[model samples]
Target chain A: MNFPTKVYINEVVLRDGLQLEKKLINVEEKEHLFKRLKSAGVQSFEFGSFVHPVRVPQMANSGELYSKIQQAAGDADLIALVPNLKGAERAAQLSVKNINYVFSVSETHNLQNVQKTTLESLEELHEISDLCIENKISLDVSLATSFGCPFEGEIPTDRIVSIVHQVTELNINTLTLADTTGMANPKRVFQLISLVRSEFPKQKLGLHFHNTRDMGLSNILAGMNAGVSHFDTALGGLGGCPFAPGATGNVCTEDVVHMLHSMDIQTNVDLKELLKASHLLEEIVGHQTPSYLLKAGPYDKKYPVPVST
Target chain B: MNFPTKVYINEVVLRDGLQLEKKLINVEEKEHLFKRLKSAGVQSFEFGSFVHPVRVPQMANSGELYSKIQQAAGDADLIALVPNLKGAERAAQLSVKNINYVFSVSETHNLQNVQKTTLESLEELHEISDLCIENKISLDVSLATSFGCPFEGEIPTDRIVSIVHQVTELNINTLTLADTTGMANPKRVFQLISLVRSEFPKQKLGLHFHNTRDMGLSNILAGMNAGVSHFDTALGGLGGCPFAPGATGNVCTEDVVHMLHSMDIQTNVDLKELLKASHLLEEIVGHQTPSYLLKAGPYDKKYPVPVST
Candidate 1:
C-alpha cells in the first residue's frame, strides 16, 4: 500500500494526444497550448512526433513547433517522439534533449502500428539509440502493448521482460510500459510494474495508460503503490488509440493531479492553473474533454446544502 | 495484490440509480428492469425505498413495485431502503427480505440530507432495528459520507467507527461505507476499509462508490485488495447524491464486472447479458448513460487493423 509522495507527470497532449484527434491544431495554437501547460507547472512536455507527416498529418508541424516552443519552454524538458533513425535525426537537428522511441511488444500490433515487426522495430530502436547518443540526447523507449494487445490477447510477462532487457542493453534506462488499449487492471498493473522494478532495479519506469475501459486512474494507483512514480498523462484526457476505435483519451492530467494532491501526494503541478489549461483546451478542441476536475471541481469545493425533508 | 476469486455485486440501480433521475419510471418499467438485472445474474438488488412519497416522489410506488417483483425475484435477495420506523413498517408489510437504513457519519450531512442530527438518526435506527428483528427482515445499515461529506470535509475515522459501533450493537452486522460524494481515493479507501475490518472482524462490509471524481473503480480495486468482497454498483453508471450537486453516478455495474472478468476474477455475472440490460436502461432513460462498456465494447473485442505505411 506504499505510494510515492512525489511523482513526475510528463504531459503528452501534443504528441500522444492530438496525434489521433479529428481537428488539426495549427502551429500557432500549439504554441499557445505549450505556453499554457508550462504556466501550469508542467516541467516536462512531449511536444510532437518526428513521424512522417503523411502517416500522421496532425504532427506534420513538429519541426516548426519544436523551434517555436523550445525557446519558450525555458528550463522545462521538451521531448519529441521518434519512430526510427530518420525521426531521431530530425529531432536531434532541433537540439531536443529527450527523444522517445516506441515499439509494441505484440508482434501484430508492432506491424500494424509502425509497419515493422517487433524485432525490426528493436533493430531500428538500436539505430535510433545510437543517433540520440551521438547528438547528446537521452533516448527513452516505451514498450507499447506491454500489458495486453488488441490483436493478440494477454501478453506474457516474460515477453515484456525480454523486450526490456533488449531496450536497456541499448543504454535506454528510462522505460514506459504502455497500456496501449487500456486493457490493464489493477492486479496486472501491480504485477507487471513489480516484475519490471525487480528485474531492473535502477531503471526509471513510467506507466502510460488510456481511459478506454475506465481503468486508467485505477491502474495508475496500482503503479504508484508498486513504487512507480513517473506517469504519462494528457491534458483534458485527449488522445485515442489509432488501432482501438472508440477507445477514449489518455488519463486526464488535471484529474490525476487533483487526485494526487487530494491524497497529499506532491505532483508540483498547480491544480487550478491546470484546470484553466484544460478549459482552454476544451475551447480549442471545440468539445468537452474527459476531465473529471473540469466537470466536477476539486473534492474540497462546496455544494449547496441538501434540501432536507 | 490479492483480489477475491468471487465478488458479490449488489445492484442498486432501481433504488439508488433511479431515485435521483429526472424521469419517473412506472411500476411496470421497474418490473422490466428488475427482470433484466436478474437475468444478468445479479444475486441481490436494492429495488425500492420506503421513504415518504412527498419527499422522494420517484419512489412513491415502492409498495406496488415490491409486490409486483417480489414473487419474481426467486433466488435473488430483494432489498429496500427505509428511512425511519414508518418506512421500515411499510417495507415489512411487503415481506421484504432485506431492509437497508442509511445515515451519514458526518453530522452536517446527516442533518442536511435527512433533516436529523446524527444522534437523532441513531435513535430512530434502534427502533427500526427492533421492528426489523420482529418482522424477521435482515437489517443492513449503510454509513453514508463515511469517507467524506459534501457539506463537511473528510470524516474522522473515529466518527465512522463510532457509527459502525452503534449499528453493529443492534446486531445488524452488514454495513456499507458509502462515498456519498465520491471523495474517497485509493489510499483512503484502503485505510478506512482496513481500519473497519480490523475493528469489526466478523462484520460483512460493502463499499458503495460514485464515479464523480473518476476514482470509483480505483476505490473498488483498493477495497478489493483490502479483502472486501461485496460492492454496490448501478446499471449504466446511474445514481447521484440527491444532496450533492454536480456529483456523478455510481460505478457502472457492467464496467466493474468487465474489469473483474478481465483480471480473471469471477463475479458469476453475465457480461453480455448485463450490457443488454444496460442498453435497455439507456433506452428507458432516453439518453446516453455513463457506462464505459456500452460505449467502448469490452476489452476482448478487437478493432480492425490500422492501415499503416
Candidate 2:
C-alpha cells in the first residue's frame, strides 16, 4: 500500500477536454484557462492538439492557443497531441517542445478511430518520431485503448507489452497507456503496469484513465502502488468517451490532487487554486462540470447549518 | 496487490437507499425490489431500519416490509438497522434473525446525529446487546464516523479501537466501520482495517462508505487488501451524506459488482440482474440514478455508431 511521496499530474483540459466539447472555446478563453491552470501550480499542461479542425473543431485554435500561452509556459512543460506525421509537423512548426502521438493498440478501434490499421499507424509513428527528433521536440508515445477496447473487448497484456517494446525500441523514453473507454480495473491496471515496468525498467510511464465506470481513482491507486506516479487528468473532468456513449471524461484534476494530498502524498498542485480554475471553466463553458472537489469541497469542509431567515 | 477470491456484499439499498430518498417507496414496491435483489444472488440484504417515522419517514414500514419479504428470504441473511434498545426490541418482536445497532464513534457526531454522547450511545448499545442476546438475534455493531467525522475531523485510531473493544466485549462478532462522509483514503482505510483485524482477530467486518468525495471504490480496495471482505452497498448509489450536502450516497451496488467481476474477484451477484434492479429503482424513483454501470453499461458492452437520421 506504499505510495510515492510525489506524483506528476499533466492537466489535459485544454486538449482532450475541449476536443470533445460541443462548443469551441476561442483563443482568448483558452489562454485564460492556461494561465489560470498554471497559477494553480500545475507544472505540466496539454494546451491543444494538432488533429484536423473539422474532425475536432473545439481544438481548431491549437496554433493560436500555443502562441497565446507560450510566454506563461516558462519552466513548465507544454504538451500537445499529434495524431500523425502531419500533426507532428504542425506541432513542430508551432515550436511545441513536447508532443504526444496517440494511436490505439486495438486493431478495430485503431481502424475505426484513425482510419489506420495498427501496423500502418506504427509505420506512421516511425516517420512522426523522425520528425519529432529532427524538430528537437520531446515525444511521448500514447497508446489508446491499451487496456481494453470499446469495439473489441479485452486486449491481451502481451499485446500492450509488445507495442511498448516497439515504441521503446524507437528510443521513445516516455509512454502513456490510456484507458480510452474507462475499461481498466485495479487488478488489471496493477498487473499491466507491473509487467510494463518489468519489461521497460528505464521507461518513463504515465496512465490516462476515463471515469466511465468509476474506476478512475482505483486505477490511479493501483498505478501508485506499482511505483508509477505520472497521470493525465482534465480540469473539471471535462472529457468524454466517444466510443463508450454516456461514459465520462478523464479523472478530474482537482479530485486527484485532493485525494493525493489527503493521503499525505504530494501532488505539487494547489487543490484550492485548482478548484477555482474548475469554477472559472464552468462559467466560461456555460454549464456545470463533473468535478467532485468543486461540488463536495475538501474532506474537512463543514456545511453551514440551516437558519431561518 | 492481492485481492480475495471471494467478496461479501450486503446490499443495503432497501434500508439506506430509501431512508434519504425524497420519494418514499411503498411496501409492495419494496417487496418487489427485495425479490429482484435476492434473485440477483445477493446473499445478505439490509431490508429496513426501526427508526422514528418523523426522523426517516421512508423506513416507517420496516415491520410490514420484513413480513412481506420473509417468505422469500430463505437461506439468505435478512438484516435490519436498530438504533437503540427500543429499535432492537421492535426488531426482535418482528422476529428478525439479524440486526445492526449503529452509533457514531465521534462524540460531536454522536450527539448531533443520535442525541447521545459517545458513552451514552455505548450504554444504549449495551442494553440493546442484552435484548438481542435474550431474543437470540445475531447482532452486528455499526460504528459511524470511524474514519473521519464531519463535526470532528480525523477520529483517533485509539478512539475507534476503544469502541471496538467495548463492542467485542459485548459478544458482538460482526462490526461495520462506516465512512459517513466519504472522507476515507486507501492508506487510512488499510491502516484502520489492519488495526481492527489485529485487535479482534475473530471479528467479522464490513465497510460502509459514502461516495461523497468519489473515493468509495478505492477505499473498498484498501479494505479488500487488508483481508476485510464484507461491504455494505446501496442500489443506484442511493443514500446521501446528511451533513455533506450534494454529496452522493453509498457506492452503487451494480458498479461495485461490475468492478469486482471485471477484476476476477467473485461477488456471486449477477451483474445483469443487478442492473435490472437499478433500472427498476430508477423507474420507481422517477429520475436518473447515480449508478455508473447504468449509464456506461458493462465493460464489454459496445455502443452503436451514430447514424444520419
Estimate the Cα RMSD of every predicted model relative to the unseen true structure.
1.6, 1.9
TM-score of chain A of each: 0.97, 0.96
Model 1 C-alpha lDDT per residue in residues B87-134, reported as the tens digit of each score: 888888878889999888988888766778999999999898889889
Error of 2 at A120 (Å): 1.6
Off by over 4 Å in 1: A244-246, A306-309, B306-309
Cα lDDT of all candidates, in order? Answer: 0.87, 0.87
Question: Which residue pairs overlap in candidate 2's backbone?
Answer: none
> What's the true lDDT of residue A189 in model 1?
91
Worst 10 residues of 2 chain B by lDDT: B239-248
Tens-digit lDDT string for candidate 2 (A155-221): 8888888888888988785699999888999999998999899989999999999988998999999
Q: Each prediction's DockQ?
A: 0.70, 0.64
**Clash number for candidate 1:** 0
lDDT of 1 at B253: 98
Name the lDDT of candidate 1. Answer: 0.87
